[model samples]
Target: MIENIISALFFLAGISLSLYSVFMRYVMGGSQSWATEIFTMMLVWAIFIGFSTALRDDKHVSIDILYDRVGPGMKKVCELVTLIFGIAFSLFFIWTGIDMVSTAYAQEIRTIDAGFPIWINYLIMPIAGVLLFIRFVEKAYRFFLKKEIPTEKEAGSEWQL
Candidate 1:
């Protein structure tokens, strides 16, 4: 719940910064170079954070043609396969992301306009990957132990409480 709120706030801040940048450029006839760069960094963070949120809510794009036609037993099999694939994919990102962020930090990389440490933006990749991995684990547990899978509605309603 707290993570979701943080993600939302991050997204809102990005949007606000972008709009302010545009207003400064067009309406005020002035350039705010740092504003755009900062907004870009914020956008990167928001997108990475959004990936886990979407995965948790089952909002990620998926084709259900075969899944819909399968029986309950087959559905379970498919669910397992899907979970395995998701876990593997997320792990790959986590591994690569850590290396990328480390390299950026070691090199003392900085953004062009804001001069902020580039590793800060890259850090989101590994963080989001871990979040995604955790969500996959939860789904796998529910499927195996409870023989239940979350429906789209149930997934979306997780934050309602």
Candidate 2:
């Protein structure tokens, strides 16, 4: 619920800001360079947050062609393999996010439009990366160990693609 709220707020705010940018740029016959920068940041943050929510809800896109044909045990194996991949991807994301944030911070970069430290924008990367990691771990745990996410607890029921 909280995740939904945060993502929705970011998404809505980004769209609103973008629309305002368009109105100000075309209708007012002037440019709002800062609008684009700010909206882009908001949109990016919303997207990253959405990724976490999707994983938690088992709503991420999938190709179930191979999974659909597998037997029960094979299905378990497949799920485990996919879980491993998810874990790997999350770790990689976290590592790269951290690297990006650190590099930007060390260089003392700043955003042209917002005038805030550029690192502030990049900071969301590692933070969202951590959130993604936690979401991945939670889904894996619920499916394989705790089985708390209903379909995850039920054998051969998860529809992840």
Candidate 3:
């Protein structure tokens, strides 16, 4: 819930910044050069944070044809496989993201308009990767060890005609 709130705030901030930038450029007849870069940074942070929030809520997109057709045991196996894939990919993302950020920091790279350190912008990659990794671990524990099953409420209510 907290993650969702933070992600929403970042998303709204990005939209607000974009709208303000447009207003300044058109209505005010000029715009601060840093506005676009700041907006872009906000958008990047929002996207990565949103990814983690979605994973935490089990809202990530997936095709469930096979999962729906499978038995309970098979479904559990499928979920385990999916979680393994997610963990592996997230670890890779974290590793590479750290390397990229380190390189940027070492080179003293800065943003074009604001001259802010580029590494700060790239920082979200690792943060999101860590969040995703932790979420996947939590899910795997609940699914395998806890023997928990998704309730109808969690799955969503079905329509009765």
**Top model by lDDT, which number?**
1
Model 1: which residue pairs collide? none
Residues 17-61, candidate 2: write the lDDT tens digits.
Answer: 999989998899889898888898988888888888788778899
Q: How close is candidate 2 to the true structure, as a TM-score?
A: 0.86
Whole-model alpha-carbon lDDT for candidate 2: 0.82
Question: Model 1, range 59-101, lDDT digits (tens) per residue?
Answer: 8899999889989999878888999999998899899899999
**Pick by TM-score: which candidate is best?**
1
| lDDT per residue (tens digit) for residues 41-72 in model 3 | 88888889888767866677989888899899
Candidate 2 clashes between residue pairs 3 or more apart in a chain or in different chains: 62-161
Winner on lDDT between 1 and 3 is 1
Q: Between candidates 1 and 2, name the one with more favorable lDDT.
A: 1
* Quality of model 3 by C-alpha lDDT: 0.84
Q: Rate the local accuracy (lDDT) of all candidates.
A: 0.86, 0.82, 0.84
